[model samples]
Target: MNHLGDAHLRNWTLRLAALLAADTQDQLAWLGERELETKDVVEEVELLCRVSEGLAERGAFEPEDLRDLRAIGRRLGEIDATCRVGLWEYALAVDPAWDDIRSLARQFLLTRLGDWRQPLPRPVRPHTGDH
Candidate 1:
């Protein structure tokens, strides 16, 4: 077993789980607090899609979890296919597809990790330069 690989998997899993855990309103507020944008949220989802390509074989995720993961990815693909490039900002806030993804994420978290009952932690932004 690879500890480094496990750590990497854990980090990305938690990030994807966190992104899915919050609804639009909650996510908006979380990003607002961090001075971040909706693109950042989308970026996280994209990153997860790339990272989890063959993640299940690593033994970090259970079979059911992989099932849910694929479902989430499929819906996300639809969201991407339907949305116009420039319209994502508006869609992220208004699209029902995102809500569907969130629901799937919530279920995954509930059964595998936990529920979204707890408040999310603050995102950490490294200082870029002297303030």
Candidate 2:
């Protein structure tokens, strides 16, 4: 297999990032505004899973990265179920803020899966005696 160049990797990464951001925004927006049924959540989960599977097969990501993507899908599945429960129990009265929570969670999951490295944690400076 040929090694990917920096430009190639960057292009793919940026494209995937943009796609994810848009997808998350749309899904979360809907989730926030409506009390979705079980069937609705299931369909969304299926769509996300299909994308994740495609990403895994692209070979741009490592094995661990694939695992992270799958894990995110699973966790989102749980969140979808929770939303369904809330819908069933509260009807339209259910708070839509769950959209923000799920959106943030999706961002976290993407950051973990993406190859963008974070800066190293800052080291603690030695304490000075000055008050």
Candidate 3:
């Protein structure tokens, strides 16, 4: 693997973390209707895993880059789990009936975010150490 800059790794981690937080917010909002399901959560988790794994596989990244990605994944998982539990509270707050449409909306938003964060097919790698 190529050596990725520390700055690059940090930036990626921060970006992923932010996205995860945003997704959690959206998810909770949808869960207000009691539309959340185990399948939905699993899909979100899979998306996160895929993105982290892809970043690690990028040939330009160093071990540190992968490590940073793993750290971000850990944080994201925590946020996701918390949001799931909070979903019940949110549903109570809204008093909305959980329905199939609400569940679909949640899944759609998460899928969109995942697609947005997906790395390009070909990543650009530095030829050598920075000048």
lDDT of model 1, residue 97:
81
lDDT against the true structure, per candidate, is: 0.66, 0.45, 0.42
State how far residue 127 of model 3 sits from its true place (Å). 46
Stretches of model 1 off by over 4 angstroms after superposition:
33-40, 81-89, 118-121, 124-131
lDDT of 2 at 95: 37
Q: Write the per-residue lDDT of candidate 1 for residues 11-75, one digit (tens) a residue.
A: 66766676667777776665553444445556666667556656666766777877777777777
* TM-score for each of the candidates: 0.73, 0.35, 0.29
Top of the candidates by TM-score: 1
Model 3, range 1-131, lDDT digits (tens) per residue?
34455346534543433333343454454344454444354345445545555555765344554454454444334433434453343533343322322333233334334433332222224356877
Weakest lDDT window of 10 consecutive positions for candidate 1: 80-89
Question: Candidate 3: misplaced stretches above 4 Å?
Answer: 1-19, 23-34, 59-65, 75-131
Q: What is the lDDT ranking, best to worst?
A: 1, 2, 3
**Cα-lDDT of candidate 1:** 0.66
